[model samples]
Target: MQTGNLLLLLLVMIAGAYYLGHRRALILARPLGGIRHLHSLPFYFAMRSAIWSALPALLVLASWLAFENSIIRAVVVGGMAESAQPADPAAMNLVISQIQNVASGAIPASFVSQDVAQAAEQLSRLQNLSGMAMTVVVLVLAMLGSAWAWLQVSPRMRARQKVERVLQTIFMVCATLAILTTVGIVMSVLFESMQFFSKIPVTEFLFGLQWSPQTALRADQVAAQGAFGAIPLFVGTLLISAIALLVAVPVGLMSAIYLAEYAPARVRSFAKPALEVLAGVPTVVYGFFAALTVAPFIRNLGESVGLSVDSESALAAGLVMGVMIIPFVSSLADDVITAVPQALRDGSLGLGATRSETIKKVVFPAALPGIMGGILLAASRAIGETMIVVMAAGLAANLTINPLESVTTITVQIVTLLTGDQEFDSAKTLAAFALGLMLFITTLVMNMVALHIVKKYREQYD
Candidate 1:
């Protein structure tokens, strides 16, 4: 049976185990007057049975699936003649792929060697047998576990304690997996970035002024060892993000304040949702809007005023990005603002303070930390944005701070560097990991700064 269908059957068995356990508990309790005499609740007994029926079967199924293919491949390869054996990892991979293709009918048997065809047949047979064995073993284990739990369901059993311990273990395992996954990502990127920095000096990458990444495919080919200056990319990212924040922060904060404080209930209900709808619109749609409408309009306006504006300027991308992130700042700020103690506002008003005065003196200070956090989130979103920048901002790695001129961000360059078929051994390709590492560091520093600010103000307010 398929793994998914087997899982469904396991779930059905678990459910049946739970029902049967619950019924048995009731039958056992009826002769003793009531469930109050039992050590734990009937629900715990049912849950314990369900857990027993599911956990062992799941573990066995997972282990089997994890090792099944490798074991099958080893067996198939071992069965082949000594001369047919692969000599290396690459050759082994090629042989395996050929066998898999033949087995899957992507390649016909008559096209391949006799040994490979025979191996494909063996592969197909082993796969079917493995599936059948897995299905039977998993089902049998589940049934045995359920039967054992059914026999163990007694008034004296500490079913609640057992169930709680099992749940705690599961939660801890999930948390550990999350931490390990994050560490794995950081280590992978860090290792690749170290390799990149080995090829390109860290000083040259960080401080140089030019930003070309094109390199020759072959050593014999005549090409410049491309400039890997990252200063232009950094400047462009900051320029656009600064512009976006300038547009987003005040407007979003003001809208949030108005919605949370001054607006009528009906107006707030309609206006807030309408404003937030901008966030739900896809980034590609925003990119199209920026490219087709905002960029052209900005260029036309600049030309009419005797100023130069590139067809794809950072200004257009920034404006549209700001619009896209408004909901982040507005929604978060509004929630924090509303969460400020109403008693504080009332006390300020009682002292003859105006509504605006109460907001400025009593509420805004209390909500400042959350507002800063919201702004930081919006800033991060703006920094990481790629689709809008790709569509609206041209990929010119110019070092100028001119918002009217075209610019590109680190994310855009990362996408550009790794878009098509490329060798990871090349500095050009490895530069993507370097760029990603820098971006990660930049974000981490931003988070630290923001946290420090939030902590300082939060402590004072608290």
Candidate 2:
């Protein structure tokens, strides 16, 4: 049976177990004057049965699926000609890929040796046999667990405690999985970045002015050990992000204040959602708007005023990026502003303060921390944006603050460096990991700054 079909079967069996367990609990209760005779609720008994029936079968299925490929590959490869034995890791991987491709009919068997063709046939047989065995074993274990759990459903059983404990364990397992996944990502990037740093000095990467990552594929090629200095990328990222924040923060904040404070119920209902619709618009659509409409307009206006504007200026990209992130600021700020204590506003009014005065003195201060959070969130969004910038801002890693000039961000360069087929061992490809690590650190610092601001404002309000 296919894995998906087996999973469906397991769920069906679990449902049957739940029904049987619930019915049994009710039958045991009826003779003793209703459900009050039971130790716990009938639902708890049902859930305990369902958990037992599902968990063991899932474990078996998961384990089989995990090791099936490697075990099958080893068996198939063992029967091939002695000359077919892989001499290295890369060769072994290539052989396994080709074998799987032939088995899947992605590659013709006639193209390979008779030995390899036979191995592919063996692989196919083993895969089918493995699937059949897994289906049988999993279904049998599930039934066994279901029968065991159903038999244990009794007037004396602490069904609620058992069910609760099982759920708690499941939650902890999920949380642990999340933490492990995060650690795995960080370690993967860190190790690759270490490989990159081995090839290029840390100081040169951090402080050098040039940002080219192209490397010569041949010894006789003209490409000089392409400069790895990352300063230009950092400067471009900051320059564009600063422009985006300048455009986003004030406009979004004022919109939030007006919506939360001055707008009527009807107006707020329509306007808030209408503004948020901008957030749902895809970033690529914004990129098109910037590139096709905004960039050309900016260039035309610049020429009329005797100023130079690149056809793909940072100004156009930043403006559109700011529009895309407005909802992040407005939505968060509105919630916090509306949450300010009514008593604070009343007290300010009692002290002869007007509506504007109450807003400025009593409400805004209380909401400052949340507003700060919203702006910083927008700033981070600006920093991490790639699609809009890639489409609108030309890929020129120029270290200048001029908004009318074209520039590229670290993310753009990372994508550029790793776009086509390349060797992972090459510095050009490894440089992407280093750029990713630096981006991670930069955002971490930004988060720290946001937290500090939030704490400062929170204390004043408290």
Candidate 3:
């Protein structure tokens, strides 16, 4: 049976089990005087039955699916003659791919050797047998589990406790999975970065002034050793992010203040959603606006003032990025400012403070931590922005701090480095991972600082 069909069948079985368990619970409760006398409610009994019928079946199904391909492939390969068997891992992979293609009709049996054609047939037969076996096994397990749970159901059964424990365990497992995923990502990046640093010195990658990742992958190919300096990328990222923050912070904060504090209900209702709509617009659209409209305007305006402005200047990218991130800042700031205790505001005013003074001294300080968090989020968003930088700020990797000059960021460089078919063994491809690690560190530091500020002020307020 197909996996989806099996899942649907399992759901039906679980529902039927639930109904049986509930009916039995009610019957037992009637003999015991009432459901109030039972250890748990009928609802918990039903849910316990459903959990029993579903959990074991799902676990078996998942395990079967996880190893089904490898098991079938091994059986098929082992059936082949010794001379026809693959000699290396790469060769085995290639043979497996060919067999799969033939089985799927992407490649005709006549196009491959007789051994491969035979293996494809064997693979198909084993897969069908495995599916049938899996269906039987999963259904039997579900039926047994359901019967056992139904038999155990009684007026005194602690069904609620069992169900709650299962749910708590599931939640713990999910949290562990999340932490493991983050650890896996960090370790992968760290390993690849180590490989990169083995080729290029850490000092050169960090403090040196040039950024060039183009080099030959094979020893026979002629190319530059490639300047691996990342200082230029860091400068570009900071310059653009700083510009974006300068524009976003002031405008978004004022907008939030007006909407949260000054605006009437009707005005806030209409304006808040409209302001936040900018966040939903795709970054690529912002990139196009920057490249086509804002960049040209900046260039023309700069020429009129007799100043040099590159066609793809950091200023153009930063301005458009700032506009794009305005909604992020505004929405977050508005929520935090609105969340400030009304009592604080009332107390400030009761002390004969004017509205402006109350907001400046009382409301602002109370909301400062949250406001700082929003700005950190916005700055992070700005630093990680790739499309706008690529479109508006050309990939020149210039080390100058001038906003009018063309420059590139770490993200843009990472994308450029790993764009097409790349040999991971080469420094060029590994540089992408090194850049990723740097970006991750920068974001982590920003989060740490923001969290510190939040923790320090939150205690005072609480």
Candidate 4:
């Protein structure tokens, strides 16, 4: 059967089973006259049964779909004669591809022998047969299990509680998976970074001022030896991030204040989302804006002021990144500020404080922790941002603090290191991982500090 037809049939069966379960639940719950006697309504019991029935079969189907190709390939490869197999693995793979193409009718050629053709035909038939059989068996088992569950449903079933518990567990598992994924990524970065550190000393990477990532592609090429110092790149990253923060923090905080404290209901509603439109603008657009508009303006301004300026200055990139981060800071800060107890503001106003005074002295101090948290989060974002720096900030890794000079960042360096033709096991690729690890660590530290500060502030307020 067609895949769509099979899916439709499965869905129909599940729905039919659900209806049957619902009816069974009603029959079982007939003894409970009033709603007060039962933990949940009969339909909830049916829903529980339906979910239990469908979930296992769906899981089986999904797993089968995922692994069936590999299993079929393995079976076909194993059935091939030893003499027929190509000596080289790559050639063997090509032969397997040809066989599969011929079997699927993509290659219009008859098999030299009847045995090979027969085997290919049998393999295809077996795969389809197995998939269909598994689907049917699983569906039947699910229906039977659902029917049994429906039979077990009674006034004392506590179906609602059971269903809720199952859902809560599923949610917890999903959350765990997310957390585990992050941990796995961090671990992978750490491992590769460690491998990099083995070849290049950590001191040179962290404190050395020069940044060059070019390395020899082959062992025989002795001419290429690349510098791996990260200080200049890190300095550039800091410069750009600092610039972004300088632009973002004040504007975002002030905007948040106006929206939370002074704006009228309609104005607040419109302006808040309007401000968020800045956040919605893609970073690539901001990158070109930095490169095309901001960089030239800064260079011209510098030249007019009798200072030499590079076309790709750090100031432009930093300034644009700051603009990008504003909405993030403002939106988050506004929410936390608004969430601050109204009672605190009311009391401050009652004590003969002006509206501005109340906001500055009472509201601002109370919301300071949350505001700091937002700023730190924005800082993390700035530190990690790639496109804006890549486009506007020149690739020259100058260790100078002068924003008018060309500067590079860790992210930009990482991008340059891994791009183009490169070996995975080389120092160049490994350096990318080290930079990633540092970035991860920096963000982690910032987040922890922010969380601690927010917690303390909350404690004081409470």
Better of 1 and 4 by TM-score: 1
Best by TM-score: 2
**Better-scoring candidate (lDDT), 3 or 4:** 3
Candidate 1, residue 271: CA error in Å? Answer: 3.2
Candidate 4 residues 1-462, lDDT tens each? 555766777787678767876787666556666555766876778778877777777777778778877788777767777766568887767766776666788865474344456546656776788777876867776777677777777777888888889789889988999999999998899999999999999999998878777788787887677888998988888999999999999999999999998899999989999999998899999999999999999999989999999999899999999999998899989998899899999999999999999999989889989898889989988998989988898788888999988898888888888888777788989999999998888888888888898898878887
Candidate 3 per-residue lDDT, tens place, 1-462, comes to 999999999999999999999999999999778899999999999999989999899999999999999889988999999999999998999999999999988999999999999999998889889999999999999999999999999888899999999999989999999999999999999999999999999999999898887788777889776999999999999999999998999999999999999999999999999999999999999999999999999999999999999999999999999998998889999999999989999999999999989889988888989999899989999999999999999999999899999999999999999898888899999999999999999999999999999998888888
Report how far residue 340 has shifted in candidate 4, in Å.
1.3
* Model 4 TM-score on a 0 to 1 scale: 0.87
Which candidate do you rate higher for lDDT, 1 or 2?
1
Candidate 3 residue 366 C-alpha distance from true site, Å: 1.4
Candidate 2 TM-score, C-alpha based? 0.94
> Which ten residues in a row are the worst by lDDT in model 2?
216-225
Mark the regions of model 2 whose C-alpha exceeds 4 Å error after superposition: 218-223, 459-462
If the candidates were sorted by their TM-score against the true structure, best first, what order would they fall in?
2, 3, 1, 4
| Cα lDDT tens digits for candidate 2, 1-462 | 999998998999999999999999999999999999899999999999999999999998999999998898888998788887788998888888888889999999998877778888999999999999999999999999999999998899999999999999999999999999989988999999999999999999999999888787667888767889999899889988888888888889999999999999999999999999998999999999999999999999999999999999999999999999999899999999999988898899999999999988889989999998898889889999999889999899888889999999999999998898888997889999999999999988988998998999899887
TM of each candidate vs. truth:
0.94, 0.94, 0.94, 0.87
* Cα lDDT of model 1 by residue, 1-462, tens digit: 999999999999999999989988888898899998788899999999999999999999999999999999999999999899899998999999999999999999999999999999999999999999999999999999999999999988898999999999999999999999999999999999999999999999999899999898787989867999999999999999999998999999999999999999999999999998988999999999999999999999999999999999999999999999999999999999999988989899999999999999889999999998999999999999999999999899999899999999999999999998898899999999999999999999999999999999999888
lDDT of each: 0.95, 0.92, 0.94, 0.84
User: Which candidate gets the maximum lDDT versus the true structure?
Assistant: 1
